[model samples]
Target chain A: MALTRDGPRSLGEAATGGTLRLAGYLLLGVMLMMFDHRNGWLPRLRGAAAMLVQPAWRLAATPGRLVEDARRQLASAAYLRRENARLRDNLLLANVRIARMQALVRQNRQLKRLLDAVQSLQMQGQLARVMDIDLDPFRRRMVINRGARQGVHVGQPVVDAHGVMGQVTEVLPDTAVVLLVTDPSSALPVVDARSGVRTLAYGAGRGDLLDLPDLPVTADVRVGDELLSSGLGGRFPAGFPVGRITALKPDASGSYLRAVARPLAHLDRSDHVLLLRDLAEPFGPPAPAPAAGPPAALLGPAAAGSAAHPAPALRHGAGA
Target chain B: MMRLDGQRVLFYLSLALAVLLLLLPLPAALRPLRPWWPALVLVYWVLEAPGRVGLATAFLTGLAADLLAGTLLGDQALRLTVVVFLALRFRARLRFFPMTQQALALLLLLANDALLRWLIRVVSGVPLPPPLAWAAPLAGAALWPFVFLLLDALRARLRLREP
Candidate 1:
């Protein structure tokens, strides 16, 4: 339809048309905003819209990727050698750590057996590259290259080398949006490493700081204390480093202490992140290791107890 | 009847470039300084070719912007409709003004757009935008003169007849 009549129109007619059009759009905007707020009805539409803009996002990132590739290709041999040496040293150190970890794993298994607890599956993480960063100042989010096709689902925890980055919030067919922990709306359950006191940490909407708004005034939360995921909600796996307490001050009301934390993840610079996924259950301890087998003697007192209580062990192991 | 003109290609190309700029990431410190590129382009067309860029065009552009920036749907739609409406209402005066004066008008238009957007966002449960949301209007207005000249040059170079 023509925005205005074809013939020359009076100023009054033009003004009335403009007012009517503005009212119509404003009404549409309010309706949409209300619908989205009340029902979150636009995500499917948002996903389709994201698909339309996906190519633009990729095209926008190509120049930066090209520059990075060129830089890598043009790196000096000496610099590359130094980098390789550093990586080798890191690997050596990591292997040494793994050696220690093996003993710890053995001890953990023995302890679990003593307690008659079931074995936990090895957690796996998938790698994804950051495709685009959200430009909204109020919301700290980014789009990653993984999505439903890659088995990425909403609420999967994402982490970088340093610590917990955030969780996937929205997934498309080919890409997903991650809500960083620094966004005002993001909250995660964390436990103090020193005291094991669990508290919910929230994003303060400011970079480099997370808010713990519910800490009691008498709580023993000290600055520099490391916080790890407590896994209370089952959304994020337990024991991932989240952040460290950076500041604490009494609330203006004097009933609670307001605290701040510095997340360990490089929220701004990291181009890659890890998406944690739960592994499928393994067979139940090999069916009690075939009771009559010769190896049954190696079952130990704990295993015998577990075998006697096969009902509990099987249930716990299967649930995990 | 309108024929396919070389200037239509130039128009769409510039609009695409503006979209690219809108999507381009900036350093953290400078991110808040990004101008409203799509709005600027929209306002330019609303002024120079009012018949081509109207309320419907502005609405679609705003929707595209919302998806591109990952904001709530129709947030930019509302703001852009207001911008285009105001531009169209005053296109006669705005087109006659010197580029510098037109920039001033653009500053008001963009500031109004940002304020309206911020209001809608907050009302719709988004966290209150930081002070830098206001700073964007200044940036948008500052780029107006350059954008105006560049698009003008493109149009003149294409030698497309104005309606």
Candidate 2:
């Protein structure tokens, strides 16, 4: 009776109900948007929701996993034979390289220790696995499986086998997000490996390119020149390959040249990255003091000048 | 009347099935081709059970999808709200249209949703690919008849009827 006989009355009620529902939905949307945008509420909620859905994701992923396993099984025999042959060839070559590299590494380590005593101290690092790519593809970011629980902190430099990948921007309980060098907001100080001329590389917002701006027309740069992190800004470690200059063209304004580089790290394919815990220092050892005081004859003039230029001595003392 | 209510229930169940299908671990290449399953499901439900499935239902379903897709919160909610409102407003005429015409209308509706989503992403400073992203709507439109038929079979099996 409630279903059949009351159709017209129910229809009238439904119209009013629909209007109320629309208003309610709009209010709910506004509330959720505000919560997500302003407060740090959504990440916790999202993490909890992700936990709840983990079982579902596992369930959904099972069939695909099984299919993959089956395919691998079917291909196992021939695949193993080919893989074994390749490994054998690589093993022979690697044996020779490893023997030479071992001596080189020992010498390098001794040199590094001597340098470390004179230079900045080295800090520990942790390895993390990339769990997910950013849902918003426009921004270049990856969420790593490691978080604060694993000692991952915001601002840690994330690197991969190829080079500097990015830095940890956000740390959650079980995950952290790395903002890649390809992200539009990212900038890194780099030097031309050939000429040692330092410049800033800015992300072009496009995933594939980094742009170097304000380079003078006479700047000694060319296509194929490797760029290394200069460690000038203290944000990244020195000597890590950042990118290779791939294109250079004079700007229409002609005052400067437009240059683009392809980042060395494979932004999309990397699954594991290292987070360097140590922060690099901004300024290196202060300019060495004048070897000795000015020559004796010049001393009088220098002493008179020193009294007038007390600021330089003050700066020198501050630097020490 | 009892039959019509049963049909409505069948519609909701079909939607749940569609959501499950959408969650299936599609190959990386096929992932983008995965049409807006929830959108199509909501469209079907709103066409059949406008009273039971209205703007609120659409908004809530969209919220669930946003969570599942890991997109910014309330994005799908806003899109679904607009979509369900349009579907409800046009339900009477939609029901009278032939399957081909209905599919065309669905295409237009999906295109509108895609445009709104693109606009929201742009406003939020997310760069989107060009008009090529609307490929999802074209695929969804092509699948509309198959989706309708599949739901019709399920409803018949469940002994559901129309009002």
The residue-by-residue lDDT of candidate 1 on A113-169, one tens digit each, is 999977463689999999744446567888888989999999888999889999998
For every model shown, what is its TM-score relative to the native structure? Answer: 0.86, 0.71
The C-alpha stretches of model 1 lying farther than 4 A from their native spots are A1-13, A119-121, A279-320, B1-3, B160-163
RMSD of each: 8.9, 9.3
User: Per-model i-RMS in Å?
Assistant: 4.3, 5.0
Candidate 2 Cα deviation (angstroms), residue B135:
3.4
Candidate 2 residue lDDT tens string, A56-129:
44444456557766877888687989989999999998899889988986777789798874445355678877
Q: Write the per-residue lDDT of candidate 1 for residues B36-147, one digit (tens) a residue.
A: 8888988888776665776878887777777777778788878888898898888778989998899999999988888797788768878777677678889889999999
With a 3 Å backbone cut-off (N, CA, C), the pairs that clash in candidate 1 are none
Enumerate the candidates' DockQ scores in order: 0.39, 0.25
Which 10-residue window in model 1 chain A sums to the lowest lDDT? A1-10
Worst lDDT run of 10 residues, candidate 2 chain B, spans: B25-34
How much is the lDDT of residue B131 in candidate 2?
42
Q: Looking at model 2, give its docking quality level.
A: acceptable
